[model samples]
Target: MRKEVFVAEQRVPEDLEYDEFDAGALHVLAVREDGVALGTGRLLYGEAAVGRTGGDPSVGSLGRLAVRKDARGLGVGVELVRGIEAAARGLGLAAVDLHAQTSASGFYERLGYAGYGDEFHEAGIAHRAMRRSL
Candidate 1:
């Protein structure tokens, strides 16, 4: 799923797309009735999320959110994000943070995430830090 959206389509280097954090992160996958995946995301907490969340233990970092091109505009991305946030709350996190692609910031903002800090580039795509309290 990520390979299709990030690595292949978005051109995020495969090596940079998958990281050590994946080992312990809570992953979410949205699938159809027949089991075809529509989207995916992950939640990083505790020590694994320190660097991403500015060392905030109470926050969970959300990453790798990707929805299939055909599945987009059908609410898959929103559901995936909500699923990740639910996982964060289940882990007792006070907030969820994510580095959203600048172009997609509006989508996340509509979901109640507020952007903070300056825009930065990751894998050559501009992004901004965003967060929402659980």
Candidate 2:
């Protein structure tokens, strides 16, 4: 799913789409009743999340959120993010942070995430750091 959205559609380098953190992150996948995967996301906590969470142990990093082309606008992305946040809360996390693509920042904002700092580029795409208290 990450490959389909990030690597292929978004043109993010394939190597950068999958990283060391994936090995330790808590992944969430949204599926239909028939078992078709609709979207996916991941939560990174503990030491693995330090870099993304600004060294805050009580926070988790949410990443790799992607929805299949056919599943876009069907609430798949929202559920995937909620699932990741629920997992973070289960781990005792106080908050969740994500690097959202600039174009998608409004979506996160609607979900209660507030953006901070200047915009930055990741994989040649404009992004903003956003956070929400759990």
Candidate 3:
């Protein structure tokens, strides 16, 4: 579902859609009872995550979060985020950070992430940096 949304639908440039960090990052997939992926997210820890979270060693970076368009408003994204946070907690991380599309900052704020940085363009879309302590 994430590939469909982040890559195909959103056209997030294939090169940027995936990277070397994937090998070491923890990936979380949201699926239905029958095993269909509804959404997906990933957590970057240690050195590989520095750039994504502004070099905060105690923080894990959450990225590649995407939900199937059909699954929007069904809470799949919430579960995907919870799963990523759980992964961060398991790794002894103290917080999580993400570059959220500005339009979706409210959604992340509602989930406990606080936006702090000036808005910027990422992949040609307005974005804001947000953080949440575990």
Candidate 4:
């Protein structure tokens, strides 16, 4: 599903889409009543999130968030984020961090995340680092 959104849809390179970090990250999924997956996201905490979270073990890094095209305009994305935050709290994290795609930064900001640092590129797309206290 992440490959569908990051690779096929968004044109992010396949090799870059899946990484060593995936194995240690906590994945969250939003599925349909019929068991079809509508969206997905992941949280990286502890040592796994150090690089993204600025070496802050107390902050879980949220990433790989993707909602299917048909699922847009629905609340699946928001729910997935909330679910990730819940997972972070479960792990005793004090905050959640993410490198959000520039296009979707506003959406995250609306959800109470605040951006920091200048924009940067990853996989050919611009992104901004953001965080929210849990």
Question: What is candidate 2's lDDT per residue for 42-79, written digit by digit as tens?
Answer: 99999999999899999999999999999999999999
lDDT score of residue 134 within candidate 4: 91
Model 3 misplacement above 4 A: none
lDDT of candidate 1 over 19-108, digit per residue (tens): 998989899999999999999999999999989999999999999999999999999999999999988988999999999999999999
| Candidate lDDT values, in order | 0.95, 0.94, 0.90, 0.95
Ordering by lDDT:
4, 1, 2, 3
Q: Which stretch of 10 consecutive residues in model 2 shows the poorest summed lDDT?
A: 2-11
Q: Write model 4 residue lDDT over 32-77, tens digit each, in one string.
A: 9999999999999899898888888899999999999999989999
Q: What's the CA error at residue 61 for candidate 1, in Å?
A: 0.4
Q: Number of the top candidate by lDDT?
A: 4
Over 18-77, each residue of candidate 3 has an lDDT whose tens digit, in order, gives 889988989898888999888889899999888888887889999989998989999999
Alpha-carbon lDDT of model 2:
0.94
RMSD of 3: 1.0
Off by over 4 Å in 1: none
Query: Ten consecutive residues with minimal summed lDDT in candidate 4?
Result: 48-57
